[model samples]
Target chain A: MEIKTLSQDGVTIVTPVGRVDTSTAKAFEDGVMASISACNKIAIRFDEIDYMSSAGLRVVLMAGKKLSAIKGELVLINMPEKIFSVFKTSGFDKIIKICQTFEESKQFFN
Target chain B: MATAANILVLDDDEDTADLFRQKFRHQIMDGIYKFSFVIHPEEALDLLQQQVFDIFISDINVAGTDGISFIAKLRKDYSFMRSIVISAYGDINTLRAVMRGGAHDFVIKPIDFKDFGDTLAKTVRVVEQLRQAEATSRKLSAISDELGVSAQLQRSILPSNSLKKGNIEIWADSIPAAEVGGDFYDFFWLNNAKLGIVMADVSGKNVSAAMFALIAKTLIKSFSQIYTSPARCFETVNRTLYNENATSMFVTAIYGIVDMEKNELTYTNAGHLPIAAIRHNEDPRFLECEAGMALGICEDIVFTDSVHTFSPGEMILLYTDGVPEATDKNGNEYDYERFSEVLRQNAIMSPNLLTRALMESIREFTKGMSQSDDITTLCLKYRLRVTPNVN
Candidate 1:
């Protein structure tokens, strides 16, 4: 899996490509968590990822927890319908901030 | 190991002895070939018993014993030594028989000494490589033994008794993927004889995972005693785990209090799957709610408990992701739909039978294929209501 983390306008965008199941969860978690340490206002793009397991959700949960403790902001952006269903079923969509596109997430980050 | 090799020969003629002494004069001066030529087979056998040689070259005809019989004796007596047969070009049948009897190689009569020397050297090198490989295999087997002992120790700490308490029967069991796992289930007595149910899956495998699970179980058990509410106990345990953790390890758990006196269950599903239940003439379904974030991530998040009131002949199931995530030989996952179907079929059974029936269904679906994660299931059934007027 290719995980690209870029900072633009003080917002770190983590875009992970390919499947993020048990085998790649550790690498994906480390990339996102490192970006959190560097910047608090972060957005993750879920469009590139085709599949994710509970292991992937575990990383997002930890990142959410850590960001919450520091009073920081996190947003899930450009989420596909399939990926959003997972978040919705887990009840994470209710507690976490999400947007339909990066443009929508910009205001939420501010 | 790279030193010159000693050479032994058996032949009847003294000319054969002089040919070797003259031919290897330079090698002898360099301490390479230490040649000993014996005319009689009995004398050569006696010389072999007295000392060792790297190569034993034998001719087809000799005094007292034929060269073929001598080679056979040399093979039986000194199997470590590599024997080379000196045969005439026409003696292909004899050469083939000797090769079959484990001669390292056979050289034609009037042999080219340099080619024979190279063959002997290669044979010795192959033997050394075999010895090294054997030593490494022995060392690895010793490490495997230690892994087995660690798995045994982990199983000993888990409670396996299928016990019943206060009109409730429970069965909680965990089977690891490759001998050990990070999944755990526990049921303990809390305030006012209330049964506290716990089901958790930590993110890891083997020994480190087992150690983390021990810490999680102990902290939850201790914290439950200190706090009366399940939500409070989970919050304190999560705070403790997050503070003590040095690695990125985390646990998704469900901690609940099953109050037999009140016919109620107060639970906090911390980033775990919604609890599965079969209640009062209804189908099997998950008790959906906003499960909080998992433990050992951040310390400040407070968990909230959701309460469920049940009737007699109703059962609650708690499990890790291992059951649905397990794949068959064809790599098809035994998903939630299959799990619910099994629960629906065995809805009215006792806690023990319900758990057994679900496990049997899973086994049938997977068809003995090895799973990648740990499978843990806990069933709590209220055989009779604590207070009969809650309808």
Candidate 2:
């Protein structure tokens, strides 16, 4: 998995390419954790994700928990329909802030 | 000596033995160092082959061999053994040869007993560190071996691959991954008219997932008998799983009951995938229902039950995330498109053949890649629904 991190105006956007399963969840976690360390505001872009196992959701939950502890914000954006379906089925939508775009995340955060 | 490091020293000089023994006599008595001197290179090689020694201290002019070749052979064959070469004149060239030949350190001759002792002690400390690391690796391997044995025993206790009762014919199997996975399934006779079915996957893998799977399977089976509706049964089981979830792990499951008298299959989903249905002469489709939150995530979730008709020869397939999510070498998923294709082509297949076809399809798509998740599937075909008038 290749993770691209771009930070602008105090917000870091993480774009991960390809599957996020057991083999690559650690890399995803590391990228997200790195972003969290540098900035409190983060948005995960799931546009290129092919598939994500429950292990991938575990990482999301972990990121959310870590950010909550710091009184920081973690938002999910641009999830593919299939990926969004996963979060919806898992009821993660109930617990996390999800939006249609990074702009929407900024508006919601503001 | 309990903690003594056995040191093998090679030298032709007969007086070297007595000098080492005399100088380290107090240390030997205190059980810290034990020196074994060999006059010939062959004798040193013989002892090296037979036993594990802590250190090899050799003189460059030892009898029967050139020192560099012998030290190099020891370095190649027993690289972990600490070696120190003796440079007879504090010769820089001899010291360079010793280092190049892979000897760890060198001591000069006319030997400084105190300096020599200090060098040997340093090498001994390195040897002790290696010993501790070896012990830890051994312990870890032993623990993994135990996990392997426990997984085998659990496989023995898994529900049989196939079960038939009344009008329902079921074939269920949970394949074990390289590591122990948390997938489990079962189908049992609840009564003459009711049959219970379960398919579930606990989050993650390893011992905790295995244990959680076992606990959730047992509780679901027990609760199925106590509650008639799948919703009610899952409600109680969900609470138990939530209470028991210290690690915050969750279980995605579908627990259903087939009522032969009513010809209905009613089930409750807990964050599991949708059940696929293959009805004769009708388009294959996933059962329409709420996929719901997984058990142990929240304690207060109110589960809802969904109903599907079990018409004669209707087949239902339930699987874990391993299926469909199985990725190829190019990272493309064997997604629901393939899943439905398999179901459509094998709609008339017996529960057993349908399962084989599905697994073979997945295997074909993921021939060279390794799947980390457990692939579990349960197939049920209602051979004929029970009706008093038909009999």
Candidate 3:
């Protein structure tokens, strides 16, 4: 998995570019941690993530809880349908906030 | 090596700087070395922070900071660069200070042009060797990472957990050796009433064999959907494999189609191991078949098929040779006799427990020796719902 970070209006945008399965889940975690230390408002764009298994979900949960502890916010945007279903079925959608577009996600930080 | 080597020089004397330019005139003209000079030690320290240099050449004392203290700072931070200290004093204390400060070499002033040139050449040689070693180490790490990803990719291609469809509960498990193996097993619904099952073993080990196993599995599956008849499916798969067989590898496989409504299983064997089945209240026995040749050989060979009616509470087991052929520390195999005996004894158990019992028995027999081949097995139990009578 490749992680690209962009900072826009104090919100960190983390874009992961591949399957977030068991093998690459740790890399995803590290990428999130790198972006987490820099800013409080974070947005993870899942447009390029093709397949995500339970391992990826675990990382997402951990990121959510960590950000919550610091009174920071994390929003997921542009999720592909397959990965969205996995999130919904696993009940992660209820715990983590998700949005359909970048503008909507940015409003959470505002 | 073609790019000019960046060299940083710190000396207070102007003539010494001129001497270096004159001495390395040929190398500088050839574009082999690029030189940068700093008259003050503090200025050199600031320059060091801004850019990287291949070699550091400094005198014992400069305008503001001493060479030993500067060398100490450089060693604490950018220790990878080579440092050569030039000094007018040849005392043992000065030599010890230079060495303790992490200087690569110490040269006395009143420098000889020939000696200086030779020293510079040696320093550059050492720098090149270090770069080459670091590059090789990085390349090796990249290759290791790619292999790890390949292994994980291979694992993801396999079916996860057992599933119950129609009247059959199917469980398949495979434990690959330390290296990747060519064992493969798959089951999918051919229709609402029929389930297609496949178990195969390719000829070799490692990546190439695993790739061949994938191709063979895919071809057999696609062929089964098109042909329907077990024997005809094998024939078509064999012909396709023979045409595409570039590695000269062969695959031993057995394909079965189970019809839930008819309670019948029709199967074809391609030089694979005999499957064991336990009918209701009967001892486990190997299903009989005329063993045909493995696929990826000759294209003209025809395969034969066998049929068995599976009653409720009956179970059938399919496995690769890795099970019976598993070896002990004394090199004795578990053998087909013992394998069948274990199945016969545990025939009444559920498919999941039975498979786990067999795996545990094999582990006990092997005494934790490294596996030589992949051990794969599939246990399919035909379960019927028992209806309680209400009065």
What are the per-residue Cα lDDT tens digits for candidate 1 across B239-277? Answer: 999899876577888999988777888898777878998
Error of 2 at B293 (Å): 0.9
TM-scores for every candidate against the unseen true structure: 0.61, 0.67, 0.56
Q: Which stretch of 10 consecutive residues in model 2 chain A shows the poorest summed lDDT?
A: A101-110
Interface RMSD of every candidate?
A: 3.4, 1.6, 19.0
**Cα lDDT tens digits for candidate 3, B1-391:** 6678778998888787788888898899998988889888778878888887878888876623466777877877875578888877787797797779788887887877688778887888788777788889999999999988987788765666487765788778999864677889988788888888888887666577778888888888888889888889989898999898764566788999988877888998886777889765567888988667677765775878899888788899998877976778776778777787778777888788889999999999999677766799999998764557888
Lowest lDDT 10-residue stretch of candidate 1 chain B: B61-70
Candidate 1 residue pairs in clash (backbone atoms < 3 Å): none
Candidate achieving higher DockQ, 1 or 3: 1
Candidate 2 lDDT, tens digit per residue, B1-391? Answer: 2578988998889898999999999988888888888998888889988888889988887733477877888888986688988877777876797689789898888899899889988988987888889889999999999989976788754688897777788888676664678888877788998888888887777688788888998899899889998988988999999898876677889988988888899999988888888986677888878766788777878889999887678999989888878878887888899988888899998899989999999999999987667899999998774456853
Distance from true position, residue B190, model 3, in Å?
A: 6.6
Give the i-RMS of model 2 in Å. 1.6
User: DockQ of every model listed?
Assistant: 0.20, 0.33, 0.01
Q: What is the lDDT of residue B206 in candidate 3?
A: 55
Ranking by DockQ: 2, 1, 3
The CAPRI quality class of candidate 1 comes to incorrect
Per-residue lDDT for A2-96 in model 2, tens only? 99999866788999998787778889989989989988888999998888888788788878878888988999999889998888877778778
Index of the highest-TM-score prediction: 2
